[model samples]
Target: MSNSALIERIAARGDGVTGDGRHVAGAVPGDRVRDDGIIIPGPNRAEPPCRHFGKCGGCELQHVAESALADFVHDRVVGALAGQDVPVGEVLPAQLSAPQSRRRAALTALRTGKQVAIGFNAAQSNQIVDMRECPLLLPELFALIAPLRDLLADIAPPRRPVKVKLQMLDQGVELVLEGVKAEGLDAAMALQDFAGAHALARLAVDQGYGLETLWQPEPPTVVFGDVTVEVPPFAFLQATTAGQAALVDAVTRAIGDAGAVADLFAGVGTFALSIQQGRKVYAAEGARDAIAALMGAANRARALVATEHRDLFRRPLIPAELNRFGAVILDPPRAGAEEQVVQLAAADTPVIAYVSCNPASFARDAKLLVADGYTLDWVQPVGQFRWSTHVELAARFSK
Candidate 1:
């Protein structure tokens, strides 16, 4: 009746099926269950070594078998789209890289009077767990967590558990550390010491109110498909390397050999630059900061990318504007592109590649697109956020 034994027993009892016939394999119950009692493949059927699996919010499927998890998610998307007569395409295999891939940026909370700890928001709470290691981070980043704790000790509290966000870019890792009441040389020296010890490429310390400076003791570089992207601190970027590669490939294939393409809600030009092959790409975003990053990325790739800072929802599509492109590539937020769907339904654009993170919204939009004379050509599911109920999807719509 020790805690370990108690947890194990609970995991065992909670691991399969409940009285109501729900699958208890994953930490979150009610995930997969069929009339014949077939549990969908996911973290439900397996056990993970991390003691924090269920407590920590990072891995939703930690208790389920990793091998079967991806397909389980794929099935969910297919089911959603089936109602629209939209056939779901192949489910891209899950890219599960350990330690380094778990996050591009994380919002860590302060633990009172102890070492600095980083992991994720607690189960349904804003609090972060003081974690030793995560299976999702890169090995190098995984190695830095303990040392990062030591570095945080130098800074005074009331201002503890600073929000830290890190991203892997073309050149190197970008670090953004936020302190509520930090300032002056004390903050700079503290960050400097930590960066030197960790051999970080650049350090960005948030000075209570805003960004202080990008400490460039030395530059760090990350490689992606023979190209290098410079990562600025606090800039939005993908967390996992393998996941990004799959998404880029999906967008490229969806675009085919289009001469003119429009990338909607393009962030850092991940798809815009990737799809440009001596073609014109108009990248648009609502945020000026994101648009700047998109422009920078396009410049780095030497691709012909024209950027516009406009709210796609408010403006939707003006037929005069929509007719300029043969194809459109959209990567919208979780809400998905509702207004764009309405506009596209009325437009003459022949092709559309819609990338979404929410299946419900994608399905809702698919119904509208089908009603507008567009057919779901294909859908490729990408497990960008693994170990969670959430899944990323890319689909092509053609006339």
Candidate 2:
């Protein structure tokens, strides 16, 4: 008899798991692993598009078929809820971002002699992969990699790694380089020419002290609904436009007809501004710069979005304050809003749209809400970081 085990599903870390509790790397659902440690390609295995698929840490599930990828995303959410014994009324279909849809990325660059290597770090290592082509980044963003290598070779310190951040703004791509020094007139001119030649919205560098803008012809802005926020350099943004749309749509649906909403942990008014048309939104964030940008945008747009710079972890909304809102939107960091959720569960809030990047933390908070009589109405999984183990989700809870 053949000694082989079938991969049943993908685990949280992107490893294909067998029924008997064995984990296989680079295996997808339906794949068979022979006793001699050879993988037999299964129906759900896909041909990875990028040459750096296995080496680059940017993506993990590129070898998974579309259907299996979606399943992995959905199962991640469902399994998380199950672990917490939280019952969900429905598990909606997973929304996966298309190839080349990533709008923001943080890459690493290192210069050795005359050559420069720029790309994501290798899997489980600090070494750069030297990206030549990527299917995860937008075409416009990917096009800059080659030129960036050339640019970094001149400015990047010898054999020292530099952090490169690329984000697409309303004007154009914003580039920020850390651990790079450009001294004297000629180097400064090169930096200016590079930004202008690439039509970059903003280019900032950090040598040691702090980030200093080298070239910024115009403010780097991002639009959240009708409001235009002149975002700070390398501010947080949804990974992809499609993913943002899916989350926004789900949030809008989750808080149907609610006239008053409290957006906790609101970053740059991504959800508050998007849903502030007829509704009165109260946006609270811990980051000063993000809240300031949101406040400025709301003030200029004259939108019914009030901004507050309050750290919810230290001082979450009390029951009295929480009860005021007809609905609530919670988009906390990876460590979910446990402190805030406790207050929300004690309050008489009617509806909630909890958006989370980490399913484990989300489920833990969901248990608290459910225990307080809130129903887990539905969950919508979003594969924003495509071909990766990272998962995002939006869920509705109602009393």
Query: Cα lDDT of all candidates, in order?
Result: 0.68, 0.95
What lDDT does candidate 2 reach at residue 106?
96
lDDT of 2 by residue, 1-399 (tens): 569999999999999899998999988989999988799889998889999999999999999999999999999999999999999999999999999999999999999998999999999999899999999999999999999988887889999999999999988999999999899887898899999999999999999989999888988898988889989889999999999999999999999999899999999989999999988999999999999999999999999999999999999999999999999999999999999999999999999999999999999999999999999999999999999999999999999
- Please identify model 2 stretches exceeding 4 Å from their true place: none
Per-candidate TM-score against the hidden true structure? 0.83, 0.98
Best by TM-score: 2
Compared to the true structure, candidate 1 yields what TM-score?
0.83
**Candidate 1 wrongly placed segments (more than 4 Å):** 1-44, 83-100, 159-161, 217-229
lDDT of 1 by residue, 48-86 (tens): 767788788776666655555655566657767875666
